[model samples]
Target: MKTIGYQEVREKLLAGEEIAIVDLREEHIFAQNHPLFASNISLSRLEIEIYNRIPRLDTPIVIYDDGDGRVERAYTKLREYCYSNIAVLDGGVAAWQRDGGELFIDVNSASKAFGEFVEHHKGTPSLSAEELKAKIDAQENIVILDARRFDEYQTMSIPTGMSVPGAELVLRAPSLIKDENTQIIVNCAGRTRSIIGTQSLINANLPHEIFALRNGTIGWTLAGQPLEHGQQRSFSDLDTQIDEQVKQNAAQLAKRAGVKQINFIDLQNLQAQQDKTTYIFDVRTEQEYEAGHLPASRWVAGGQLVQETDHYAAVRGARIVLVDDQLVRAYMTGSWLAQMNWNVYVLADDFAQVLVETGGWKPATPQIDVDLFISPDELQQLSTTQNIVIWDFTTAANYKKGHIPHAQWVLKADVSKLIQQPAFTSLDAIVVTCGSSLLAQYAVPEIKTQLKSGQKVYILKGGNAAWAQAGLPLSQELELLSEEIDRYKRPYEGTDISKKAMQAYLDWEFGLVNQLKNDGTHGFFVI
Candidate 1:
């Protein structure tokens, strides 16, 4: 495979050239340490996720693995799909460190750094957990707005917090506020969303005192404050006048942030340009996007797009177009992207007729050898007599919900480690499954490589979903063979988390700025 040095890649990013620097490791490993802008596209999901993220086959792409020998395999696989311009990082991540390149931990380093930059530059107002708790106890004339996804708010929130996700804060705030005397407090699980949400209201010139719940629910928990569970307070619809005012306010903020507005014609012309890569996103709620959305537009809610930019748009320096019918969501999201130094624009023209999709999108399945797959019926028959081992590659939450009976839960990255276990060493045949069978197919080859000679690997056709459809029994019992650390458990995800875990989470987020300072690779500029 061809190779590119760290300095060259760094220089290219600094120059704002379109390039996709992909870390070919699982999410957990990628989060441990990767270049500031590297997007984690694991080898197992590369084919399934690549087309949506990269789009242009000729776009410059760099793949790296921490000398784990996965980069070459990823390069080979990409070549089979006819990707034109691809290179492996020279000496991988270790070489980058040796050459003084910055390494960032956790996902979405750029977005997180930008959040810090916003607070630093904007000096967004905030209230400590103690202060907020005292206000709540005293019954101060205030409204607590949870500026996260509805589900996240449902998981955990302040005593009387209302759900108004980031982009919706400006649009829905006016209707929810009783009077100018009512103070507004916005919060998220941690810091980024809270800061951005508070700043957004200020930018919109809301005539009320606004403060972010400092450190969010983590702060509340650490302060020995109780968080309410399953709270469902949300904003009602706004009047036409209020909606128009929100649009005007959001537009002003976007203009101040140097966010550009593009008409449909300009967007078409922009997409026609072959020299640059462009990502078109519908930045509305998933429900709205599913009901109807522009053709070729991917669904990423405005808040999540800003919080997880790397996951949605892997190609740095690529042009991004944000679309929404209400105009406020798109402008608000575009404003943040512009401040983060992305070449971002909001669609200015109405394209309501283009709304085409009516249901959830299913990713196109990659072409895999049919022989590698076994029918659900066949697996059921084989399992009766043969000593079959089934590995479920789905998320821990999904595994807990339902999985094929007797399937062992394991991370794809940990499969090699499982080989040393006595239970797996004597397996007669191995079957792999995920929510969908696509990831299972990608994993089959790797599983085969690690197996003893003559040991066979097969994918359960259509995965667990198909097994259920075939009237097969599913076990809700958890059968984990690996530690459940592949994905970080959010302190606010479930109903019951100890105060100790919440404090630890806050400590982790609090240290990220120093980590970024030490790494020094992130090229963030706040406007």
Candidate 2:
């Protein structure tokens, strides 16, 4: 087995070498502590996600954990999947800490930290929640833009705030504003999206005075300011087209950030490169993307691609080609991504004939074994007649909302461990299921290894959805066989979180600028 020291990993990062530092812990656990550039790829999820994330199987890779033996198992699994050139970190994250390496907390730490760093270097201006509220009360001429997704804007937003999203701001702002007197304010649930968005307009030198709503909705909540729920106002795209001047400005900004402009022919050539992993993303809004898009391009809105870079591009040094019809979005997004030191490019092939494909974005869902599945009728009959256990590998939220009456929500990694317990012994059968049974199907071979002599494992055909569609009853009952570690309970999300936790989250974000300095390997450039 090969091992990499922390110093070597740091050196690779420093020299801008191609490498992927994959943390093997579960997402919530990975959020607790990890190296800046490390992407979370849980041991159980590696098989399902590896093909799409790190496309090049031979890319230099180092897997690590918090002093756990999981890395050895993961290494073996990667080899079985034909992923060569793999190594484990010496002593895991413990060794990194001993060598004075910074371990950041929370998901998307690098992006969030980079946002803070951008504000510091660019001197981006902002106004507090109270100040903005006072202006609204005084009947001032202002347009508040929620730079997050439309779904997030619908949750809770500033009064009269419109959903402009992140990359769509500059494209749609011209139509929303009547004159140069109207002030523009950008905001999100927290600070990063709003900060990045606010700066986007500023960087383009748009005539309006742009400012970020300090602290966004989180700050709005803390100040005892009321947040509007279910507001549907947004940037209207009808009768509106981006002006030529705006396009020129956006292109210049991207060029300043060292972004390259590539044509369709160039893209095809890059795809032919066997050694490089290329992530082609269409940085457009959902409605526009569903109407039409380029082939082999995934629809990740520009803002989210920047906000959650790790989730989209796990291979740190991979080439990212962004596509958009309106040059503003692709260039603006390419500008920020390039500043983040990504090998970023904007599609220059005018999009006239390239957008022949249509439909929403689809993931490369892994193929599953059809022979291992049993129909809903079979599962219902088996549940009533035999001693059987049904384990669900779906998300915690989905399980809580509604699930099969006797199904227990459990993590895939814990499924094998649970069957060894006294209560599960001598079961007649074991059934595994997820949303559509695809994920559950991925677990069959491993579950077979843990089954007792005569015990069989089956996937519930079409999973929970099929059961519901057949007029079968579903329950909201809690049947927990594993800890709920799938998704982090975001302090800034939903209405039930304690104020203390929200304040703590904000405090952590405030210090990310300093953490970026401590990490010392983020090759970020702010222009």
lDDT of 2: 0.87
lDDT of 2 at 8: 92
Runs off by more than 4 Å, candidate 1? 236-242, 371-378, 385-387, 413-430, 444-461, 469-471, 476-485, 490-523
Error of 2 at 446 (Å): 1.0
Tell me the alpha-carbon RMSD of every candidate.
3.2, 1.7
lDDT per prediction? 0.82, 0.87
lDDT of 1 by residue, 42-144 (tens): 8756778888888888999999887766777778878877789999899888898899887777677778777877887789899999999899999999999
Candidate 1 structure lDDT:
0.82
TM-score for each model: 0.89, 0.96
| Error at 476, model 1, angstroms | 4.9
| Highest lDDT model number | 2
Q: Which residue pairs does candidate 2 place in steric collision?
A: none
Best by TM-score: 2
